[model samples]
Target: AAAQAAAWLAGGGLPDPEAGLKWGYMEGATDYLFEEREPSPGVAYVRLVPVLRAEPTGHDLIDELLREPRSWRWDGHGESMDWWPAVLPSHREVVAVNYLPHLLYQWNHAGVYPPYLEALCQADGPVGDATAIALAYFLSTDAERGVPLLLRMAARGDLPAAAVGRQLTHLIRRAGHQTRPVVAALAVAAREGAYEQVWEILRAMLPGLLPGEGERPNVTHTEAVTLAADVATWAKAGGEVPATVSAYAMSKRTSRFARECRRLRTQLT
Candidate 1:
């Protein structure tokens, strides 16, 4: 089904803005098909939005479509078949009405968008998973917010532990923070057992306190050591321990500190 859609788009069968298309496999079909059409404009727009599947071709199709020199205009009905129209009186409105929802729906249905949009968003620097999370956070509300954000954060292995930890701590300190809710949201990623996030949080927070001071009123080294140990254990078990752990350990000059760090690294591995 996806191949057919790609061939169609590649062959220049422009998308009917009114009749959205889902460009991947469907229930009983091998290739992609025009799955649904809604009577109402908004509904139809949401229904027909194309979600690319697989690689190379999926990516190629999107690039081709985006590059087509067309000023897209959405009719009042929220659908337009024309690739390039003379007047797009409501460019912003058309984008919001016809494009934004589809982009968001792609995010919701495909787990993530193609690298093109993701790269566009992070073009300035290493935005990492935060870019994806921020989009999801804005598109979704309340209960749906943290789950997607955390998932993206977890996937982007390049994120520094310190940065992730700080974000997690800040979120936990927010007025509405609830342990169960926060932990539950994070648990999915945690189950992947990548302790980089846990370590990242600890590494970020530990340096902020005075030598003997704890992060929060009741938190203590015992707690810190325990959490660190737990993270180390999980990371080692999952074979996802960051090389930084050993590097940080080896860079230390103090014999005792170096020994402890090495021990921690060993434990994590």
Candidate 2:
């Protein structure tokens, strides 16, 4: 309904050519100047869109997002770039991040790739941070493609650490026990000035990084732990290690990871 209204306004419903107002113009807008929240419970106030600039960005999704800035609620709506149509061509199935493992399998069988990856993997690719993050959901299992792409992005500093921090945390959480490669890759990125990003990911993922109860750590799992400890030390981050990790650190297991965990215990203590 609102789209139709916008279309009608774009059509012949505009008042006059002399009138300076243009539809969807978001200029001279400040939170104090406009309503940040609904004026009343269960009621929305009329939006005041001030027109200060009329030039288009030549990108549709960017335009729409900037169109109704007040109406965009990332907290309420899905934060993926998949919520709207993209202007660029790509083999990606939009909104497929949750089903990425399955979608990637099908794409592999069909011998195709998400075209956006080509640019995203390059230095300062044409894509934005949201696109890179959305695609990162499958990074751990997507060893052939997504992992390499992530490594390159981190190495080149293609996106700001702050912009990708939350997604990086989620990436490690999704990886679980298979976090060795990603953690190792992140250690390199940390030395390149993303140590803060590594620390944030560990804070969010350490408790869950361990194997399930009563299950011994596999080779890959132990490697992940060792790399995580290295990152914690590099970041000089000292906090209470999760109870499970602390318990294992106290045990007499003499493997590389157990030793590292004990060292971590000494530092964190």
* lDDT tens digits by residue: candidate 1, 216-251: 223233344445656656665333333433544677
Error of 2 at 62 (Å): 13
Alpha carbon lDDT of each predicted model: 0.38, 0.46
- Candidates in order: C-alpha RMSD to true structure: 17.3, 14.4
TM, every model: 0.31, 0.46
Candidate 2 residue spans exceeding 4 A from truth: 1-104, 108-138, 141-180
Give lDDT tens digits, candidate 2, residues 90-209. Answer: 312121222222221232232224444544344222333344443444344444565455556556655334324444444454322246655655555566565655565555555656
- Model 1 lDDT vs. the true structure? 0.38
The count of backbone overlaps in candidate 2 is: 0
TM-score of 2: 0.46
What is the RMSD of candidate 1?
A: 17.3
Clashes of each: 9, 0
Of the candidates shown, which would achieve the greatest TM-score relative to the real structure?
2
